[model samples]
Target: MNLSTSNQPQDSSIHILHDKESSHQELGSPSEDTDQQYHHDWKYALKHYFPHYTYQPIGTVQIEERPSWFYCVAYGIQHVLAMFSGVIVLPLILGYDSNTSLFFSGVSTLIFFIVTGGRVPSYLGCSGSFVSIILTISNYTSTSNSEMNTNTAAVQGAILVLSLAYAVVALVVIVFGCKWLEFFMPPIVTGSIITSIGLHLSFLSYDEATKSSFDTYMAIATASAIMLISVYAPTNALRRIALLLGTMTGYFIHAMCNLKGVGPSIDYSEIASNPWIRAPSVYFNLKFDSSSIGMVMPILIVLLAENLGHMKAIGSITHRPMLRYVGRAYLGDAMGCFVASLTGAVPFTTYAENIGVLSVTQVFSPLVILFAAVFAMLLGFFAKFSAIVKSIPQGVLGGVTIILYTLIAITGIRIWVVNKVDFNDTRNIFVGGLPVILATVMQTPLQVNNFQLDGIGAATFGSIILYQVLQGYDGLAMYRKSIKSAFNKNKPRETV
Candidate 1:
């Protein structure tokens, strides 16, 4: 009777199982088949965009390798162009002087590339999640300035110190025994975060979608056209740099318009004077004050938690065998913050824009990134190149950014697709989004002393707690009432 009906196939299955130990039984169902296919799609996308990380045997035979000189000069400049727009935006939004912000952004990017597994095929740029946090700090600092000589350095010190603390906690959690954390970070949550990032960026993208005069939407159209080509078209390695190519295309479109108005103004005297081989004068004699350091703990914790999940999501994208990328990324992130604080640089993190680039281009070599990073640092010091980069019409940058953000949104969708989740469950819908929505819409509605959480986080946890408690009572009460009703209905013997 114990004998099962299952029969092992003899030799009919010719498909070789390359995974060896791993089988369809690993997850207890054939459904993982879909998951595996989705994973394949994702890996293909990651390799295409980040060719520096993933090896393409076919590519070796098709294209000839150039001497290191031409590689460093030509391809390096392209790499710089790819990540340059991303590197400078952090300071712009953080309320720093243009020169200082630009310097720190550029320097921080260089440090990231040089340090964080230069073979990871990614760049460091401003993280959008940090935008809200930066703005929050600015508001607090500005509001508190009149009451006291509010120290920006001290605030940054707190962020750096607290951020490191958070990273350590995450690092420990990942290393020790939090593999269970994987369950909650399913595609739904990942997609929401990615969507949130793109949703936010749309405000800026719309600005770039039109011409400088605001009379024509040609630039935006050109940017969009290029994005479609990059995302959908079949082309070789050179054509894969769509965003870079798109921006150039938009510039030509703008130039044809021949408007007299300039976009953002440029300055190059310092870039001209900056030496190429000199030690970077970073980590300025900056010191943080002790006051208000405690206030930043929540943000740090939030980012730490968010980043943990983000690593898994990125892991799903790259076919890199381990979470080494995440570990190296955090190490770089913490180091970047430390350097940023010391050098008067803006607080920075891994840029999601570059992540989206991976989704678009199947290339993933670390060497290509190493080339890109060094060139960026050189460009940071080179004033002349900086001027031309800066002179790129705002509309052009905006148009490309619109596309940059779109890829980000798509990456989120891809994550969701790969994760087989039960969206049919109403509880899931409520659990995943309700809290964030509530937190964002209603800030500090309920205050128990100074412990006031915003709408989403509060509403989220509150509703669940409330529902669980109420559901328990309601179940017990209904059970008791039902028992009484049953007794009354079955009392036929006594009544007779």
Candidate 2:
């Protein structure tokens, strides 16, 4: 009995009794360390900011060596199909040429994607959200500044200056504010703002899915199918491509149905007659007045907020930290918007349509999305190509857009939840409900100050103004001040 008591094991502090170094070798691999660092620096922030979700990196093309054109093309089509419906509409609504913007926007998107190192898998196109932003400012300046002779060029010039300024400030979100993004965008204000964005934008896709530029029901039916399938399907590559593939399929179905000829009319005549390669005009002239900056700055803030939400969403979807990737996206998005505004395309944003694409496909390669951007550019210059794509019946495109837009709305809700927003609070309730409801109302053809604030009517009240008023009276002002302190203790306090 005494001899048996000596056989007990003891905890090892340093030296192991057996050949345990092999176990350390197995567990302490360099790849594992790199992965852990990646997760901590980026992925951890993603979990802190976005919805609870997962992606398995579907459809990524290998970049260890140059990828083949076939791989690029296949990936590009999927990207294009995912993004096109929402992208092309920016031109259609704002009375610009869709083909022209698409061709160039496409090109700009690709270049930026490549420049950003293909870390995000999404395409760029004309952003419809800016239709209201541009037309609002243009119409405002046109009517009020009539004595000053401000043209669309002047309107665009003002926007360009605003975007450049925004880009500089946005960088501060990283240089200073990303970790405490909630300070300025406290869950309540951000959640409300996002909800307002979603509620306001809901009808955009619905309008596309439900009606045609020319009246037709079949087209809408086709579009709706695309939207619904993309939204409801299980997350996988096939689901990611759902709306895209469905839209193409709908186009085919429409073509077959129209064998005898009946759908909204499309005229390719202008495209056919267009020049092969004309350089777009740059640095349009300005006729800025004091009031115009006041009008534009609010919309710019809303847009920047929308874009910030998107980066957060993508980070959640990819399980990657936006801290590492979002600055580039903001840079690209602002640059893209500026480029678009210069060319008479409405400003653009990162679309929620790609959320479906990610859920369905599971692949997240920035390169694949960029390829689509390059293809979009080529399409932009080719009038015939633009005309052909634009010719898809409004109803069919609408059908696709309705679901995509709704999903976008849902995405906003998802973001709100991830941020742990307390919806029960009255501040959340007031700012949340009113603007969105009013925005939906004002998004129609409305006029104030001879200014067409259009989609932004919700953010207003009295001479105080739209959601812009929130910064002055709502919790956002307090949060922003706190953020400034957190960012710079020495920063002089400024009232909203």
Candidate 3:
């Protein structure tokens, strides 16, 4: 049925048919006709982007289709739960207020949506990649409280610079497009850096988890629960919340052990005493340290890779050419990072966990994600929620993070696989493997004069430089071959 030219009343709302083919074609990443229809009117685009309407339960809800309010709220909460385990860890470990992090996550997500014109459905979460760097730069583990406060300010400033770098790149992509990014940061380099980050953090998480016998057990239990639920759950929705449920299970077991005097006692005082609803203090002391900025700069590659990879992934799922909107996606991420850095929150990224949820449910409506953002903001206002989050046992956190980091490492490998990165080519092998080795082994920061570079930064620069050097050699070899060919051709006729 050609609904396009129907004589029926033209409803002012954006109408999507229940037909899968029609929905798939019309709904994702505004087509040329849709663009012409809006005539580049952002106000009109914004209104149509988030129209208040309900649709029948089609088999799959594409990015443009808004589901009923009930499904929107339910799925939104599920998204929040899915990402919370991985998202909240960075803040809690870094001593940032978890509530504030939660709030900014939502705010950043909203900003991302507005910047992207609500076309890219993504959830902003605390970037795990920055955790190790921030800790290293701040000397967080060893600093005294007063010194730590100063260090924290320095760290915030570094993040601010990082976001600016990110924004600058986004502007470049917006101006010149994203194709050149492949020349500089191909899958091999991107994948290796990601693997290095995961490996570096895996060691840290493992150490934190195994600090004591009880902690070891808690880590085991937590990881085991998440794995079990994720793999064996009877329903998809149940599997989606595996992280949250696994953490709860670990917490329960830890509490039980504490009651039996087998582990440290549970702390309930803070939860009971904290106010129900209170504003979280905003942290904003930007002290830009040159050394810190140098340390933080390398993460820009990872953020770029993540943002691009996410758009491609979503594009593939929704069957839309999402890379066309890559610039806007990058801009959205940069703005989100800016919001996070300015507000003393960690850098934000497009969450793979929430992406996993979208892939499973086959629902990509931006409005549902909007609901999730609102819910996350609401979570930040309840002081008790933050208290309860804080109350979770350290061992449980250890277990959860270990799994999360390992998955991150595996994701890098996945990138290599998806991109068909060949190890048989000797150049590819060195390009991909050596930098990861450097990052994994170089645990401590390497200092030159007053500047310091961590393992990840070293690996990032190492891979890029190595790749360029190899390309230069290739160019030289070609030139030499061409010269020899020319010489032989000139002499061949006389010799014959």
Candidate 4:
């Protein structure tokens, strides 16, 4: 239908036009009646922009739409299960309370939703990128959880500083746009970063799973179950819940073995003794030391690469243009991490695991993620629930994580494949390989001024700088031309 305006007060007639003919028409400057109509239209758009009520589900629900309340809750629970291990494991490893991690994850995800205007479909979880550096700076031996807590303040301080650094990077992206970031983190560099993250964490998977022969066997069973369910499930619905179902299957087996006194058994005493409700304490976990800053700030590179990759992946999946939201996504994630730091939680980033879930379900509803956030928040209030999460045997988590982390690495490779990055070009090879190697090298006990430059951070910085240096002015010009051509090709056409 057409929106039309005319000056005549009494004689002006309303006309209903066909869809092809209907167009907004302005006869003259808006009269009193026209002004009221315009105001109404404006209000309608604004109200719909941030919808509160559930919307009917489409073929594959859009980010702004929702399924039924029950469906939303079910999808939300699926997302929670998808990201649960990654969200809680970091804190468990670092000796921080898992309850705090769950609370902040929910809160940060809500913050991300508000900041992105509910456009980006992602779940904020504790970051794995920070693990190596936290281990180095805190001198953590992983021998005693108490010893890790003793250094929690120092690690938190580093994260706080890194969050500020991320904020700065976000500001730059906001001002300069994704093109600025693209200059350094071209597809090749980004792909390598993704691959390196998986490779870096691979060792942990082996260690955690192989603690004993039984644990190793259980890990294999868990991973295999997840793969099988996701790939060969009988129904689409079953595939969507594959991660949750697989994890539960593995857990059941572990529990069964425990009953027979064969494998590691979960201690139920912790859950039984824990209270039903407790507020998360906000400790001043800040300790400003220059050395810590040197170590932690470099992680900003890893976070940036990861956040950018997430935006790109979601954009591709939803078939929506995400160029406009890149800066806000970065800033939102940074703000989430900053808040988490203040509350004695680990650094937060958009969870790749949840994105994998979205890819499988093809459900892009923000409400589903919002529901997950609410559930997570509720879980945080229950100390016993947090204990139950912690009670999942390490072997099971490792099995699942092996799959999750491997998928993360494959995602990077997929980016390269999708973008058709030219491996034939020697420069592309150097651009991708050098940083990853350097980062791997940094994994050792390498230090400068008592500050350890870990693999992820070192690789991130090394890739950016090395790529720029190696590519030089001539290479940059060609890259810019390519980007300009692609942008022009994708530019929308105006309708008459």
Candidate 5:
């Protein structure tokens, strides 16, 4: 069920499936028949937003099956918990409204499900892919609240443009097919870009952790806890929430330090003053700065690679033909970003953490994701919840994020490993290794008078250009070899 193999033609390395015609051939029930038979009216119309799944054995749930209401809620909570730690980090780091981010994440998830016909089960949360570029655009030298807010507004405007660009890319995929993408951004290039991004962000995390000695220790404890629980925890449930649990452990330790008068105190005033339920502070003001747009545009590549990788992974696990709907999935993801952009939130991407939950639970039901979205929205409305999220110590977040960032880098390396990218090939060595070096060293923004590009952007465009250049060189070399051989064969009796 590897989407790459399932959809590809025998002769070509990449060939996209005709989603409209071929997608439903392998489906269990006719899409129209199932829709008409089960959902006759308005009440079940809501259910139509969900995908159709047939019954599996008692323990396992497939994409189209409906679980009990209780189980749905239970699994829904599991998904939210798995995604929460990662989702909140982006807004918190960027000084955006956390409540707004939480609310729209749910909204975006609903939009994604509808646009994809509920086939691809995913959660749209604030993306870290934009972090470096946004930071480069914002260029924050002062940490004042007013300045941060100003920079955040400027970043949001750039994000609006980025979102529109993403939607355009999706539209192209829908119309022209995704074959060009495969050739343009082969696994090596995509994987290298991903790795570079991870390395770039890891430095940020490390810097944040080292702000204070106590912070550094807290970070170590948090990362260690996450690694240990994820690797050695006996139960799947514990392993799934390792990030959350590890952060909590670090938070508790920091609180104890405060009691001992050794570390910075946790600010609880916001939590105490906030009402239990309140509307999120959401606003829209898009500013289109050319420099900012240019800085952030490269993130589009990462988003594309991430979405494709996520769908392929899900397809492999579920043993389903997931890529047939990939165009729709991309559209849905773009819509999610479009919605978030209007709300002054960062763009969203498919999360691998939630995919891990699916792999372990073996539940592919989109209904569960729907419930999780509702839960996230409810949490968004609870002002106290946002306050609590905001109150998490910087050190604790530092520790947690360092691990998360490293994981991001590892994901890119995993892509190389899983796809078996050959480093022995000089072309791959240049395409993959060079971008990573640029990403690692160019941690700060590179400035050339009026032009500015961050490490992530540099790595992204650099890899693509290098890949094309190397490909051309290889092609030319092959052509020269053929010419040389033909000339030798056609020479007139030279040896006689």
Candidate 6:
């Protein structure tokens, strides 16, 4: 059954009719007994709400069936580790509690599943797309290990407003369709936005790594470990955990250095002080400022593009017609971001890292992802776990961030490469180049009036306008045709 279709069976009794043959049997009769009909309807609702585990015996692991409990748990943890490096870094960089971020990540994933009818195999995580905007609006300049941005509440309020904008975009995509969005944000524009996000944070990575000479060495060592493991691991499973393993190895080295009194020692005080079980503190109460809204709302475009691209990629991979679910995917993501923003957590989005894990492990079951979400929520409730995560050295994180951030930029370039973007045309070149340049320059923290417009904000909105204006001129298409004709001019004529 193509669940993506609007014509999916709506009859309550359809749940019991497992296959087409069975469905035919039930279609001809309506139960005259009210109690019997009500009972069947209740069962139907339960089946749709929470499906049972059924083995397919002969197909790729997919949404419809659940794997064994043991396999589910194992793959679930793998998914968590795949996304851990990306998810934890956001809160650490932005100075929010990592535990709360984990909690919301899990909650958001489940929400995504519910909205998409448990069809999409995506895991929601902290989005790098929002980093530059948050930093700009909060006016955060401190790179130290201490407390960050005193005005985080204001940033939270801006995020809350931004969530509404996401919903509006989702609604538009649902009602009018994604074609309208594609008119403005093509591969060139979207790719540039992705590239700009990584470039904008390059400075932060360097700053974190170079805090001290010893730290710089540790950072290099940590990055080396990740590289070796990711590239040379004997098994796919080990490769999946490369980031975690590398970080742990770096921690061991740091511990030894501390024992020799040559490097900063691990501070166990936070772990010792924190209770085993405690709720995440409520820090992001909304305080809507109009200026903050302008600074942050532009990010909605970037997030929309990111989510849409991911959905398309997953669709292509699973060979499922996912276009119909695009609207629900956007709405689900927007809802997750809205919930996360309320609690001072970073906004959520479909994670490409987890998708990579799915690709590698060949495990596409949604049930495994659900297990991972539960594990993430459990981590959030444990204060000790949060403290332990906090104990990870900044130099170590910087090493991983250096790799991850660089990959993000490279991923953007790959988008163009994969799409066969015609850079021969000057229009494509200008569309791609200008946004990246503007975004990179704006990384220095530019502002107008009370609004702090970061590189990402400029690049995203700027690309949209540039593409539209260039499209109006229609010069690029003509130039591209001319280039093609010139190349063919020297070729020998073929006999017809």
lDDT, candidate 4, 379-440, per-residue tens: 77778766776677778877877876677678778878988999898988887887666655
Show model 1 residue runs off by greater than 4 Å: 1-79, 89-121, 139-155, 174-186, 204-240, 255-318, 324-328, 353-363, 388-400, 435-496
Which residue pairs show backbone clashes in model 4?
none
Candidate 5 lDDT over 203-311, as tens digits, reads 8787778888988888888888889999999999889999888988888998998999987888888889999989988667777776776777778888898888888
Off by over 4 Å in 4: 1-54, 141-150, 240-243, 438-442, 476-496
Model 1 lDDT vs. the true structure?
Answer: 0.48
Off by over 4 Å in 3: 1-56, 142-150, 473-496
Structural similarity to truth (TM-score) of each candidate: 0.60, 0.67, 0.84, 0.82, 0.84, 0.85
Give the C-alpha miss distance for residue 313 in model 3, angstroms: 1.1
lDDT per residue as tens, model 6, 366-430: 88889999988887888887777778777877887787788778878877987889999888898
- How would you encode candidate 3's per-residue C-alpha lDDT over 1-496 as one tens digit per residue? 2323555323232232213235546667455566554443444534555433347487888765777889999989888888875557667776667788888888888888777656678998877678888888767751101121235778888877777778888776665556667666778888887888888777777776877898899899999999999999999989988888898999999988877889877778888999999886677778888998888888888788777777777877877556656777777778877876677777787888888899998888888888999998999898988778777777888888888888888888888999899898898899889988998888889999868888888888898888878868674565565455434522211000
Residue 136, candidate 6: how far off, in angstroms?
2.7
Stretch of 10 with least lDDT, candidate 5 = 9-18
lDDT of each: 0.48, 0.54, 0.76, 0.73, 0.75, 0.75
Is 4 or 5 the stronger prediction by TM-score?
5
Candidate 3 collision pairs: none
Ten-residue segment with the worst summed lDDT in candidate 4? 8-17
Model 5 lDDT, full chain set: 0.75
Model 5, runs deviating above 4 Å? 1-50, 55-57, 140-150, 448-450, 473-496
* Model 6 poorest ten-residue lDDT run: 487-496
